[model samples]
Target: MIVSEGQLIQSGDPLLKVDFKNVKDNVPSIVTPIVFTSLIGREVTLEKSGFQRAGSNNMISIKK
Candidate 1:
């Protein structure tokens, strides 16, 4: 995960940077939690560091 557990995140903070192609292919299933949370508020302390996939796609997960 870009931000570790208990790290405070502020608005405009980068959560994850993804390739447009990969996200375009899997938009229905992909979810960016940090980005969403930032949109609703100015900051948040992460409860989990979440997960990240290795290799080309590099998918990130917050809860699952």
Candidate 2:
């Protein structure tokens, strides 16, 4: 979500992305909670403007 079609999102960036389809309006509570756990204690940077590929991430790598 951070890096869209032409934005530059390089490796080693501290970020995470999710792709949700067919959201039934009652699943955010169930699905988002666990997904956010991975981001706990991490820093997030929001772009005021950018375009990135629209889809869910295929893999996530965390460094301890």
Q: Could you say which candidate leads in TM-score? A: 1
Ten residues in sequence with the least summed lDDT for candidate 1: 55-64
Q: What residue runs in model 2 are displaced by over 4 Å at the alpha carbon?
A: 14-16, 19-64
Per-residue lDDT of 17 in model 1: 64
What tens-digit string does per-residue lDDT give for candidate 2 at 1-63? 555554566655645555445454536442343243457766544433333354535334454
Give TM per candidate.
0.34, 0.20
Model 2 per-residue lDDT at 44: 48
- Compared with the true structure, model 2 gives a TM-score of 0.20
RMSD of 2: 11.7
TM-score: model 1 vs. ground truth: 0.34
User: Candidate 2, 15: how far from true, in Å?
Assistant: 6.4
